[model samples]
Target: MCGRFIDANLRGSDSELSHIKIDPFERRFNIKPTEDVLILAKQSLEPMIARWWLIPSWHKGGLKDFKLTTFNARIEDAREKPTFRAAWHHGRCLIPAGGYYEWTGERSQKQPHFISSAGNEETLWFAGLASRWQELLTCTILTRSANETVNDVHTRMPVILNAEERDAWLGGSDDLTMGAGALLRHHPVRPFGISDHGPDLIEPED
Candidate 1:
């Protein structure tokens, strides 16, 4: 599952880009779950903002109230899951980041690695879905079975969306399957580091 990530090179000032604003936090190398990160979604024709983790409206209580495992939704089962189906159809979103983290192996022997664009684009947007669980709002990143590139690192990767598909993903249309394969590009072993300002953290290379 995608529990951590990086969003270092955001172009908040770029008018062509969507809802992202200039974040005060310095580029992060280790972004954990429940932490507020930038998401690009739409409210009508205009882009809007949303937090990373998704909280279902049926949930009761605060941050301490729910389990932390809802951060990601499997692409194959998301449409059938109660927590994600509504958002999958009506509240689709885009999570903007430099890269994401994944892990491999048992607790003591787990490894970390990072994945990013081949060209090092300013930002990468993962397809996401969001919902408003009472007063609290939340989101979940979509994950697919690993491709050739990601197979070496982990068994799954987030559903990444390219610039052209960004508009459709955030448009909240019934066609949730559009651009599923075309928009995504994958990289298995790219440059990574332990520092906070460089690449995203995945399981350590074993």
Candidate 2:
């Protein structure tokens, strides 16, 4: 599950996210669940801010009603799960991030691992689902079983989308359903240890 991530582009001039105004976003290194996040949803050319934890529109109670984790939805079960099914079909989105955080080791000895792309790609797009609870918009990242590069750390990872995949996702077409699964495979990731927020966080700890 993707519990935390780094969003370096929140303040930068990202052409893909240019539609978003500058004043609302702040540079963030340790983004957590239930916090406000930037997302590019279907059919919209502009970026929008939404809660990181998705709250389905059908939910009648307050935002605190459901205690179950809605921050990350398993791709395999999203279509069947009541909380995510509606959003999965009609509310797909792209979550931009510099990298994501995961952990490994026994419960008492777990070590934090920072996961990012292997090369110059500054921003990684994570496939996500979004919903509206009253006037508040919220979203959830999609997760898949981990691939070779990250399987040693965890059994699951976020479903990452490339430029082409992002186009299909934002296009709101039937092709999205077919192409979504293919993008679920992990890319070559650069994993390093990070104890806190800093430039050195991306570097391997020796």
Candidate 3:
């Protein structure tokens, strides 16, 4: 499951659909779970902005009752899971991100890595599903078994969508399985310099 992510830019503007832009944050070298991140979704046939974590409206008591982790949804079980089934069918969405964070290490010492497109692509949109839990809406990223490049870092990776599939994902298409399988990209991990929030942690670019 992907709990932490980084989106240095926050899109907010008058343009209805073209407002997607990154804001200047001190470069989130390390992003933790529950932190507000940016997501791109379609509303009334136009793109809109949403936060990363799906906070259902039913969770009125505050963040506790929503015991379910609304971060990652297993590709294999999402269609049948109560929390995700409806969204998979009618409430699809997209998460626009610069990169994501993964950890690999022993229980005591965990090391985090940033994963993004190889080139200087401005953003990467992830295949996602969302739902409106009462008045509050929530969302989750879909994850499949790791590909060869990501196997060493973790057993799973978020299902990333290509440019073509972005529309289908947010269009409420019924063929979710096929649509999701078509947009995945798995890149090998190279040595890249990444800094931690507290101390300076950098690695050689691979």
Which candidate number has the best lDDT?
2
Per-residue lDDT for 29-102 in model 2, tens only?
A: 77889889888776664578899999889888777787878999987788779999889788888888888878
- Taking the tens digit of each residue's C-alpha lDDT, what string does model 1 give over 90-110? 777777777766656577656
Q: Which 10-residue span in candidate 1 carries the lowest summed lDDT?
A: 182-191
Off by over 4 Å in 3: 8-27, 43-51, 55-62, 174-206
| Models sorted by TM-score, best on top | 2, 1, 3
Best by TM-score: 2
Which pairs of residues have clashing backbones in candidate 2? none
Pull out the clashing pairs in model 3. 9-22, 9-23, 10-23, 54-138, 54-139, 191-205, 191-206
Which of 1 and 2 is ahead in TM-score?
Answer: 2
The TM-score between candidate 2 and the true structure equals: 0.82
Q: Which TM-score value belongs to model 1?
A: 0.75
Superior by TM-score: candidate 1 or candidate 3: 1
Q: For each candidate, give its TM-score against the true structure.
A: 0.75, 0.82, 0.71
Candidate 1: stretches off by over 4 Å:
12-21, 43-51, 119-122, 173-206
Q: What CA root-mean-square deviation does each model show from the true structure?
A: 4.4, 4.1, 5.2
Worst 10 residues of 3 by lDDT: 182-191
In angstroms, the error of model 3 at 204 is 4.6
